[model samples]
Target chain A: MTPLRHVFFVSDGTGITAETLGHTLLTQFEAVEFKTTTLPFVNSPEKARSTLDFINFIAKDAGLRPLIFSTTVNDEVRAILRTADALFLDLFDLMIHTIELELGVASTHAQGRAHGMANQQKYNSRISAMNYAMEHDDGQSTRDLARADVILIAPSRCGKTPTSLYLALQHGLFATNFPLTEDDLEQQKLPSSLRGLENKCFGLTSEPERLSQIRSERRPGSKYASLAQCAYELRQAEQLYRRAQVPFLNSANMSIEEIATMVMQEKNLRKPTF
Target chain B: MTPLRHVFFVSDGTGITAETLGHTLLTQFEAVEFKTTTLPFVNSPEKARSTLDFINFIAKDAGLRPLIFSTTVNDEVRAILRTADALFLDLFDLMIHTIELELGVASTHAQGRAHGMANQQKYNSRISAMNYAMEHDDGQSTRDLARADVILIAPSRCGKTPTSLYLALQHGLFATNFPLTEDDLEQQKLPSSLRGLENKCFGLTSEPERLSQIRSERRPGSKYASLAQCAYELRQAEQLYRRAQVPFLNSANMSIEEIATMVMQEKNLRKPTF
Candidate 1:
């Protein structure tokens, strides 16, 4: 068994930048076992001291020096964190310096600016998109299907809701998902409400075995979770895609982020350019 | 005013990692103007060539070498991206290699693995959390507030929804949010559904000016969106927080990411440990 290593993502604010960059780097090293924790909003010397203590404790417990990925922008807070008995890595210093030199400007060294609230318009649009994604999820509100940037069509548990929500959160895209019911699959047609909006549609299809496994978690031992049913639904849905000339992708192997962005790229070509 | 420079977040998958890291880096250079675009799922050599073309076009139009921050893991795709008429930086290679040596393992060099479907449990939990957040949004369903990891309370448009969703999507945290309505503010008490769930409650307060500005966009010129109304609501909400002893953050300056993580850190201290 691979030795379990404790990893910490430390930041002065959300810790998202640290976590995302750290996780991406960590994903490459598949042989090691990494149990990760995030310590966010560590703005003060006191908080940094406690975080350092936490890292030390975890390192001692695991008999390994914890790997601390930090983006503590504050110099004073960062000084306290540097005292931990671990292999510390600063995520921002070197890159920010290079960018600073390129632009011939000094950085503000402010906290929470990475994802802070400055532009009200961008923020409001993101919230509105989130509400829109939920309101129209699973074919609930097809009334304003025309207004959606992209309408995701997929069978139950085929990753429509999460993908739609991801698009809304990340891109501020008004993405709505419609689940293809068994009847629609059997009829080999899109839903009545989505008929005219076919141009703004994207389809998500997945493997039968994967679909079966996903469905089993929700409705154990039911026909809905059966392999045969999933195969039938996926086949019929793909046929509908081909007939309607709508582009689709297999989402069984894809993440919500992957599917959301890929859908947008496809949609971008067909939809009007901004 | 600073001259506009074209910026590109190029990635082999969702482009989220590139966009996020690039955005964080850009935030430090506050004085610069960056017109950024994301090029996602550029896995194929042809796609890479086309992305380079887009970068070149932006450079030609803007008369400045575009800054391209890429997380393209594929070597061939990366080579094509590097050939663009711009300054290019790889986001993951050096760090992943250093860690790979530390672990004495080779990287998979897989595309989409950063946010891919390697862990089924984590993916399902994220979806479950999204559903929980949606159901519990604005006190819509509070029958099982006990199940939530954190219940965010705030006045309308104070950013509870986006923060809740971001936590769910990123952390797989079951975060529910409730709007501290005018009725609750006037009564100066927690809502009936949230009374016993005080332990799980976290509050969000914002600057009255920012609140008014946010509200005015949604309900232009209405009394609810007026400065007096915003001031009164924020004052009452803060008093309620003091009475309930609920920990709160002024979200006027923080981003949704910052607010979510800070709320989690506060909730982490009070909630049970794993």
Candidate 2:
């Protein structure tokens, strides 16, 4: 195996986009091996000094050269990253250049101001709408909930939280979900909040055996981890959804991306431009 | 403003990849207005019939021809999509051809299997390994946490789930996260589950004001949504992280793509090639 190269993500704020682009670019080169670690929201000179010290330690090892992808809000931090020996991809530089070329606007060099063209008013309004919906939700909000762009109703352990976040982050959709409790199954009703918004909701079900296996790994000996309970929950959740007119998807066979996209498309939601 | 053109995304399975690529491409064009919708996981002729009906509804009053980016798994579904009088980009054709050429694999006429990669064994193993970690984890699992490809720890209402999924789906990293709860905060401890994994643990925090604002939208009137409580949580979580030597990112300002990329670089994770 090729030795792993250590890469550092130095950020002015959150270093998410740089890391994503960097990761994808790394995939293009199969000959080199890499191991990554991130330092996010690094906005201080002292932090930069410590980061440099860490880089120096890695450099002393001789085998690994640190690669840094930094997102910075401050010029001083950027300057610090620039003086480092690692290969640094500074997003502030890229965004400033791109913005200058695209819109003919000189960058202000002010902190926290950079690239991206989304209309803040519209984006904020959309988010506010979801916030309002979430706040107003009742217990019925838990079922075939229509106020959400995508509603993920799954039993415990079925990856609901991650899937919702993926949809929100990647697609910029207002995705929400609720866990399908036994009460929901016992009542054979979607939580009351979902009554009017049934068409907008989706379900995520996993194989009972798979869920039981997963639960067993966690709790080991609890009644909650029993295969029989898992089967019951799975069957009852499906029945409730079917009666409620909420379409469901099996998460067992799908990745989070697939689930998020499917729900986004089903609701005529716009995918995130970024 | 130009009237929005009807845009459709038809996919064989979940329509996630098609929508992802289509939306990214759409972002490149600002001159045209688009009204987008998707038909997901349409793998059978019956489903194709419904998709066509939906297409007709969208196109009935089209002054300009609609545009479609379709990834079809079924030949019959592809044929149906071809009959629509829209400017369509057949994505399945493009990607399958690209993959086959890159991997030297013969393309098969299989339904609902457009992106079933030839290296299934390797991909499956990676997924299983990550899933296993998720299950075995108990608010604690200290095994070489520092050795993790990427570690994500975010408080409730921050966009951890979406970011983690994007990292996993697009980049193929074994990413796992745990919530930063009140208990973890009061104790000033990284979950006992994450105790020794300090080097591997990355915290995701947001401005308490921003987080409270976010949570209030979801659960108004509850203590969980109180700005004061949120601020306290944010402060305590950061303090705990500092004491525990865990690095963290703020989620308020970053997009999901940015967060995923940031994590990928921090962990020195890899993306799949073929």
Candidate 3:
């Protein structure tokens, strides 16, 4: 058997993307055993030095080709890693060329210029909120909820939790999402917790078919998973938003990033990370 | 009131970056009111046309400068939006130039090239798993748990959820995370559901100081928020991983992306994106 391959993911700020992309790459080689490590939030040269030292340690005994997935802002730091005995791939390298060609602009060496450019803080916060909501679906989100910067109201599976968390991580916004449960739907009013924050309210609507497809992935064979039921709930949810005078967006084809951005814009919030 | 400055985020697959950047830019102008909308997964010419139509509709009524933040693979499609009356900000246009200069390489324009090069699917899975773990903090992941390509184990506030979600959104891997609760700490055994899946296990550890700082944000004055306690738990968790022979990564400074990438590489996954 081939000795387990080792790969390193180096990041500029949070290391989230490097790890995410790296994990996907690893999944393709189920047969090859490998070892992996990440150096997160490597924002400075000293941190980069530490990362390089660690990489050297990993490469010393490993016989196979070491792979690197990195998003580095510092050329000096990236230069140091170029010397590593490994196959290196970085997203910054891939995207910069395209950006220059399209915009007819030269590249700048400003650090953190691209850092918050993607709304990372809001993205992280919303991701956190989504994870929090999913784990805490016991109806506890209603109380002590002032920390929530925005509350998303939508029927089941309209991309609520994911959007919320995206807002949190990308903007440092505390986002909370409440399902317009059947009772809220029947009553056709916003959730009781969201009543006073109408100015901060935004809605996500999706085509019933799309919503059904996503729901099917988690709860197949349930009424919620059926196209008909999904359609009904979506329609009810849309009506609720309309009656409640809340601004809404259709998430039928939007990515989580897009959803969070739209909500932030609608709420007129300027996120910290981007 | 100044007409809300309108910003449109158009993306190739998921309009995440476009929207996120757009949201951040809106924040720069404190005096101006702003409205934002995200067009997600707009990877085709037809979608671009529809997006243009929407822009036209908004322009007719809003009479404001529309900022377009776009991420596109097809140059032709991206060009269609150039006619918009608003200040257009294409995400690819901004970053590509910088990336090429940094890497000293011209990129090839191959279809689906971006997906494989960046390895987004794996990150998506990690994000999904992180989201699942956050919602299911009671120490249970939903069905399809076995599908996780990699599982993360860490104590509370150890950056497990963010790392996992980053993996999911970016990489599309089936990543699941389990928190090392007090019970697990005392028992020093894997979760009952995770016994047979040891081959897929990876651990995230952090310096006690870092963990304490993170937790302090969530709970200000409590025993659980004590730095001393955090240090003890981290030590105990390290011992547990050592005894189980589960390889671990210290996330004291790693970004979420880096951690996911390391896990992917360690697993020896073949393709960049599954």
For each candidate, report its DockQ versus the true two-chain complex: 0.50, 0.10, 0.11
Q: Who is ahead in lDDT, 1 or 2? A: 1
RMSD of each: 3.7, 9.5, 9.2
Task: Write down the TM-score for model 1.
Answer: 0.87
| Models ranked on DockQ | 1, 3, 2
lDDT of each: 0.82, 0.62, 0.65
What is the clash count of model 2? 26
Interface RMSD of 1: 4.0
TM-score of each: 0.87, 0.55, 0.62
lDDT per residue as tens, model 3, B119-204: 33443454465455454443465566667777788888776766666555555555668888788878998777888888878888
Q: For residues A1-274, could you state the per-residue lDDT of candidate 2 as single tens digits?
A: 6566677766644454445434433443355556676676576888888888887788668554567766665678778877776666664554345433432335444432222324555445544543433332223345334446766677887767556655544445567767777888888877656666677677778888878877886799788889899999999888877887778777766655566655665666765332
Q: Give TM-scores of the second chain, every candidate.
A: 0.85, 0.66, 0.57
Ranking of candidates on lDDT, top first: 1, 3, 2
i-RMSD per candidate, Å: 4.0, 9.2, 9.3
Residue-by-residue lDDT tens digits, candidate 1, A104-175: 778888887666675767777778888899889898886777889999998998899888898888778898
Which portions of model 3 show Cα errors greater than 4 Å? A1-139, A213-227, B1-138, B141-145, B181-188, B216-221, B269-271
On DockQ, the leading prediction is 1
Model 2, CA-based lDDT: 0.62
Superposed Cα deviation of residue A236, candidate 1 (Å): 2.5
